[model samples]
Target chain A: MIKRRKFSEALFKALGLSALVLAVGTLVLLFGALLIDGVGRLDWQFLTSFPSRHASQAGILPAVVGSTLVMLVTAFVGIPIGVAAAIYLEEYARRTWLTELIEVTVTNLAGVPSIIFGLLALGLFVYMLGLGSSILTAGLTLALLILPVVIVTTREAIRAIPVQIREAAFALGATRWQTVADHVLPYSASGILTGIILALSRAIGETAPIVTVGALTFIAFLPPSPITDQPPYLSFEWLMSPFTVMPIQMFGWVSRPGEDFAANAAAAGLLLVGMTLAMNGLAIYVRYRMRKRVSW
Target chain B: MARPVDGPYIDSAGRGDWPKPLKAETCELSFYYGTRLVLKRVSVPIAECNITALIGPSGCGKSTFLRCFNRMHDLYPGTRYEGAIVLYPDSRNILDREVDPIEVRMRLAMVFQKPNPFPKSVYENVAYGLRVRGVKDRRAIDEKVEQALRSAALWEEVKDRLSALGTSLSGGQQQRLCIARALATDPELLLLDEPTSALDPIATASIEELLQDLKRRVTILIVTHNMQQAARISDWTAFMYLGELVEFGPTKRLFTTPAKKQTEDYITGRFG
Candidate 1:
C-alpha cells in the first residue's frame, strides 16, 4: 500500500512538470519560427519605403504609419469615454435596476466577438452615415471592439479603491465631485492608464473588425494632412480617407502564393509583435508602479 | 461631590453661552436599522471648541449617533431615523427632503476608527482638502499643509518626506496624519468614531493625547467603547445603553457617581 501511494504521488508530480514544460516549449517554438523567417527580410528600406504590388517592391512603411495613426486615434477616442463610463457606473450610480442592467450589458459586450462590432460600424459609419470605409471608420470600429474591455478593466481598478478613501474625502468637507476628482481619480490614474494601454494593445492587433468595416488592403499615400486641410482633406484625413494598416497588409501578403510575399508577411508580423510587446511591457511597468504607490 | 455653583455649568443648556449658535441640534433622535432601533431619543448640546465623549458597550449607539451629526446615515440605504436633526438654525432640518446630505458633510469633518489614508503622497493627502476648495496658490498651500501637520503633532516626523506616500507612515503617524487632513479644512465640528480603537496601547495613548490638545481649537465629539478612554480625554461624558442616553454630566461626576443606575452598572462592567 505504501509503495502504491508513493508511485501515485510521483506520477502526479511528473504530470505537472510535463504540463509546464509543454507550455514553455510551445511558446519558444512559435517565437523561434517567427524570428527564423522574419529576421532575414528585415531592413531599413523595408521599414521606411511605401508598399508596392510586386513582392520584391513591397514595403510596410505606409501600413506602419497607418497603424500608428489608427492606434492613436483609437486610444484618444476610446480611453476617456470608457474610463468615464466606468467611473460613473462604479462610483456614482445607485444600485438600481438600471445600473444592474448596464453592468450586465457591459460584461456581455466584452464577450461578444470583435467581428460583430465591425459589422455594426460598417452599417452605421459606412452605409448609413456615408463616412465610407476609411481610417476613422476602422478606428471607431476597433474602439467599439475594445471599449467594453477598457470599461471593465477600469471599473475593476476603480472598484479596488477602498471605500474609506471616499469617506475620508467626504469627511474633509469635499463635495462628491471633489472627492471623486481629487482623491479617487488620482489614486486610480495609474491603474486606468494601464488598462488603456492593454486595451489599445488589443485594438492594435485586431484585423477582423477593420476588415469588415472595409479597411483598404493596399494604400500608396499617408493620411491627409491633419492640420493643413479644412473639412475632408485626403492628405492627412485619417477619418475620411482610405488607409491600409500593418495587420491588413500582412494578411494580404500571407495569403499570396510567393515565398517573397511570405517573407514580407513574417517581417510585418514581427513588427506587429514588437509593437504589442512594447505596449504590454509599458502596461506592466505602470501597473507595477501603481502597486508600489498604492501599497499599504 | 458638589456641582460647580458658578461658571457655565449652571447654564449649560442656555443659548447665550453657545458659540457659533447651533450648527446641528438633535432632539429625541432615534435610529433604526431594520427592526432594531440603535439610538433612543437622546438629546445633547454639542458646543464649539468643547470635546464631548460618548461611552458605551460594543453594540451601543455611540458610533451611530456620531454618524447622525453629518447625516452620514443617508449613505446606507436601509437605515432609517426618526425625530429632529436641525442644522444651523437657518438651514432646513436634516430629515427634510430638500436638504442635500452633501452640504451637511461639507460643514462637519469625521475621523474614522482606522487610519484610511488615500493612496496618495503625504503632500497630496494634506493638500487634498485645500485643492478641493479651489486654493490655487502654491505658497499658501505649502504653508497651510505645514501648519496643519504641525498642529496634528506630525510635522517634525513628516516634514522632510512631504512628498512621500501616506501609507509609508507608522500606524500612530497615519492616524495623526488623518487628524491633520481633517484639520486642514477647519471644520465646524470634528467627529472621531473610535479613532484609536485599532491601535496599540502606546499608539492609543499618543492619539488620546492629541485629541486632548485638539479639543481646545475644534469642536470634537468622540465615540469610544473604552470607559477609561472616555474618562481620560473627555471634558464631558454621555453614557449610553442599548439605544438610550442613560446619563450625561461632567466627566468627573459621570465616572465617580453616574446619575442613573444603568450608567453606573455599565461603567462598573456589572453588565453591558
Candidate 2:
C-alpha cells in the first residue's frame, strides 16, 4: 500500500510538472513566433513615422503616442478612484447587506466581458454625454474596463496586512485615519503599487473596449502638445483629439489581405507585448524593494 | 501618596490589600462579544508602578480583560463594554461613551503576543506614537527613541542601526523594539498581552527582566499563560477561569496559600 501511494504521488508530481510546462511552453512559442515575423520591421523609422497606405512606409508613431496618452489618462482617472474605493470597502465599510451587495457586484464586474464595457462606453460616453470619438472617451472606456482589476488588487493588497500591525498602531493611541496613513497604507504600499502596474499593463493590451468607444482605425496627426511655449502652458486640448491605439492599429492591419499589413500588425503586437512585460517587470521590482524593507 | 503603602495582606473579603496607590481599576467590568458574555464582572486593581499579571488557561478571557483598558474591542462591531474601567486621580470611566478610545490609548500603551513592529526603520518604529501625536521636532523624537530603546535594554545593540528595518531584528530584539515603541510615548499604563509567549527561553528571560525594571517607570498589566512567569515577575496576580476572576492577591500569597479551590487546582496543574 505504501509503495502504491508513493507511485501515485510520483505520477501526480509528473502530471503537475507537465501542466506547468504546457502553460509556459505556449507563451514561449508565441513570443518566438512574434520575434520571427516582426523583428525585421521593428526599427527606429517604424517607431517614428506615421501610418501610411504602403505597409513598408507605414509606422506606428501615432498609435504609440495615442496609446501612451490614453494610458496616462486611464491611470490618472482610474488609480485614485480604484484605490479609494478599495480602501473604503476594505477598511471603513461596516458589514451589512448593502456593503455585501456592493462587494459582490464589484467582484462580479471583474468577470464581465470587455466587449460589454465597450458597448457601455459607446452609449454612455459617445452619445449620452457626447464626449465624442476622442482620446478622453477611449481613456474613460479603458479606465472603466480596468476599474475592477485595480479595486480587487488594491483590496487584496490591503487585506494582506497582518491584523497585529493595525492593533499595535491602535494601541499606541493612533486614531483610525492616523493608523491607516502611518501603518496600513505604508505597509501595503508595495502590494497596491504592484496591483496598479499590473492593472495598467492589462489596460495597455485592451483592444475591444477602446474600439467600442469609437477609436479611429487610421490616424496620421498627433494630439496637441500638453505643454505650450506661452504662459499658462499646460493644455487639455490633447484629451479631446481623435486617437488610435496600438491594438486598434494592429487590428486594422491584421484585417487587410496582405502579408505587408500582417507584418505591421505583428511588429505592433511585439511592441505592445514589450510594453506589457516592462510594466510587469516594474511591478516585480517594486514588490521586491517593499518586501526587503518591511517583512512580517 | 494618597494611599499609604502597607505590606501585602489578604483581607477577610478575599480581596488583596493594595499596597501602592491605584493607577487604574475595573469595577464590575463585564464584556460581551455579540450576545455571548466573556469577561464577567472582572474587577482587578492595577497598582501604580506595579506589575499585575493575569494568569488563566486558554480562552478564559484574560486577554479580553486586558484589551478593555484601551478599548481595543471597539475596533470591532457588536462587542459591548459594561461597567467602568476607572482611571485614577482623574476618576474618569474610560469605557464611558464620552471617553474617546484614542484618548485612552494615548495614556496607555500595549505590547502584543507577537512582536508587531511597523515596516519602518527601528527609529521610526519607536517614534511612531510621538509622530501620531504630532511631535514633529526631530531632536525630540530622536531623544525619545533613544530613551525608549535604552529603557527596553536594546539601545546599545541597536544604536548603530537605528535606520534599519524594525522587522530585520531577531525575535527577541523585535519584541524589545515593540516595547521601546510603547515606552516612547511615556504611557501611564502598559498593557502587555503575553508579550513573551512567542519568544524562546532566553528572549523570555530578557523581556521578563526588562518588565521588572519597567514597573518602576510605568504601571504594568500583563497577561501570561506561564504560572512561573506570573510568579517570577508580578507584584499582584489575578488568576482567572471561565471568564471570571477566580483569585487575586499578592503573588507570593496566591502561589502559596489557599485563596480558592479552583485557583489552587490550576496553580498545582490539576487541570486547566
Candidate 3:
C-alpha cells in the first residue's frame, strides 16, 4: 500500500512538472520566432511614418493612431455600461426567472465568436445607423463584442467581496447607493479595473469583428474633428466619417503579392504586439499597486 | 463608584419581566427563506443603552432574528418577513413596505461573525461611512475617524499607521476596526452576530470588553453561543429553541433561574 501511494504521488508530481515545462517551452518558442522573424525590421521610421507603396518606405503611423483611437473610444463607451449592468445584476436585481434568464444570456454572450459581433456591427452601426465603416463603427462593434466579458469579470470581482463589507456599510446607516458607492466600489476597484484592462486588451487584438464591419484598408488622412458643422459643433453627423485601424491595415499588407508589403505587415505586427504588451503591463502594475493599497 | 450588583433576582411576576422600557419593539415577527420558515412569530422589547444577548444552539434562528432589526436579510434572495419592527416609540415601522431599507440601516448598524474591513487604508475604511454621508471636509473626516477609532479602543494601537490598510491589523484589531467603522456612522443601535466567534480567547476578551464600553452610547443586540459571554456583557438575555423564544429577562435571572425548563436545561449545560 505504501509503495502504491508513493508511486501515485511521484506520478502526480511528474505530470505537474511536465505541464509546467510544456507551457514555458511553448511561450519561449513563440517569443523566439517573433524575435527572429520581426525584430530586424523594427525601427523608428517603421513606427512613426504612414504605409508606403514601396517596400522600404512603408510605416505604421496611421494604423497605430487608428488602433489607439478605436481602443480609447471603446473603453470610454463600454466600461461604464458594462460595470453598471454587472452591479445591478449582482447587487440590486431580484432573482426571479427573468433575472436568471438574463444572467444566463450574458454568460453565453461572452463565449460568442468575435466575428459574429463584427457582422452585427456592420448591419446595425454601418448600414442601419448610416455610420458607415469608420473608426466609430469599428469601436462600437468591438465594444459590443467585449461588453459581456467586462460585465462578467466585473461581476466576479464584485462577488469576491464579502457580504460582510456591504452589511457593515448598511449598518453604518449608509443608504444603498451610498454603500455601493462608498464600500463596494472602493473595495472592488482593483478587480474592476483589472477586468476593464483585460477587456480592452481583448478588444485591441480583435480583427475579425472590425474586418467584418469593414474597417478601412488604407487611409492616409487623420480622423476628422469629432464635431462637424452641418448643423452645429455638437451634431451627430461627425460619426459618419471614414476611418481605419492597425489590424486591418496589417491584414491588407500581409495578403498582398509584394515582399515589401509582407515586410511592412511584419513590422506592423511587431508594433501591435508592443502596444498590447504595454497595456497589459500597465494593468499588471496597477493591480500590484492596488493589491498593496488594499492589503487586508 | 457604585458597588456592582450580583446574583439572580426575580420580581413577583414569575419570570421574564424587564426593568426598563422598550427602546425598540418587534411585533408578530416571522421570517421565511424561500419556502422554509426560519423564525416563527416572535415579539421582544429591546431596552435602550443595554446589551441584549440572543442565545441558542446552532440553527435556532438567533442570527437570522438579529439581522431582521436592520433588514440585513433583504440582501438575500427570496427572504420574506411578516412583521413590524419599530425603533423606540416612533410610529415609523422600520419594516414598513414603503420604507427604504437604506434609511433604516443608517440608524442601525451591524457587525458580523467574521471581521470584514474594506480593502482601503485604515483611515479610509473608517472615513467611508462619513464620506458617503457627504462629509467631504478632510479635517472633519480626520477628527471623526480618530474619535471613532478611540471609541472602539483601537486608536492607541493603530494611531501611527492610519494610512495602513485595514487588513494589516491583527484579528482582534480588525474586529475593533470594524467596530470603529460602524461607530463612525453615528448609528443609534448596533447589531452583532457572533462578532467574536472567529477570534481566539485574547481577542474575544478584548471584544467583550469593548462591547461593555460601547453599550453606554449605542444600544447593542448580540447573538452568541457562549453562555459565559452573554452573562459577562449583556444586561438582558433571550433564550431561543427551534425558532421560538423560550424565555427572556434580566441576564442574571435568565442564566440562573430560567422560567422555562428548556432555558434551564440549555443554560445549565444539561441539554441544548
Candidate of highest DockQ: 2
True contacts kept of 2: 0.92
Which segments of model 1 are wrong by more than 4 Å?
A1-3, A227-236, B1-24, B34-36, B86-96, B138-140
Could you tell me which 10 consecutive residues in candidate 1 chain A have the lowest summed lDDT? A229-238
Expressed as tens digits, the lDDT of each residue in A175-203 for candidate 2 is: 88888888888888999999999989998
Give per-residue CA lDDT, model 2, range B1-272, as digits (tens).
12212212343454646646889988778999999999887777889999999998999999999999999999999999998898987988999999999999999999999998888899999999999999999999989999999999999999999999898999999999999999999999999999998999999999999998999989999999999999999999998899988777889988998467888999999998
Task: Score residue A225 of candidate 1 by CA lDDT.
Answer: 63
Q: Against the true structure, candidate 2 has what lDDT?
A: 0.91
For candidate 1, the lDDT comes to: 0.81
**Weakest 10 consecutive residues of candidate 1 chain B by summed lDDT:** B1-10
Candidate 1 local lDDT, A1-296, one digit each (tens): 99999999999999999999999999989888889888877888789877787877789988988888888778878887898899898878888999999999999999998898989998998999888988788877887877899999889888878888878877766777787787678788888888899889888899888899888887778876676654554444457878888899999899989888898999999989999999999999988987777765
- Could you list the CA RMSD of all candidates, in the order they appear? 4.5, 3.1, 4.9
DockQ of each: 0.58, 0.79, 0.57
Off by over 4 Å in 2: A1-27, B1-16
Candidate 3's displacement at residue A218, Å, is 3.2
A best-first ranking of the candidates according to their lDDT comes to 2, 3, 1
- Give the interface-residue alpha carbon RMSD of model 3: 2.1
Q: How many backbone clashes does candidate 2 have?
A: 0
Cα miss at A285, model 2 (Å)? Answer: 2.4
On lDDT, the candidate that comes out on top is 2
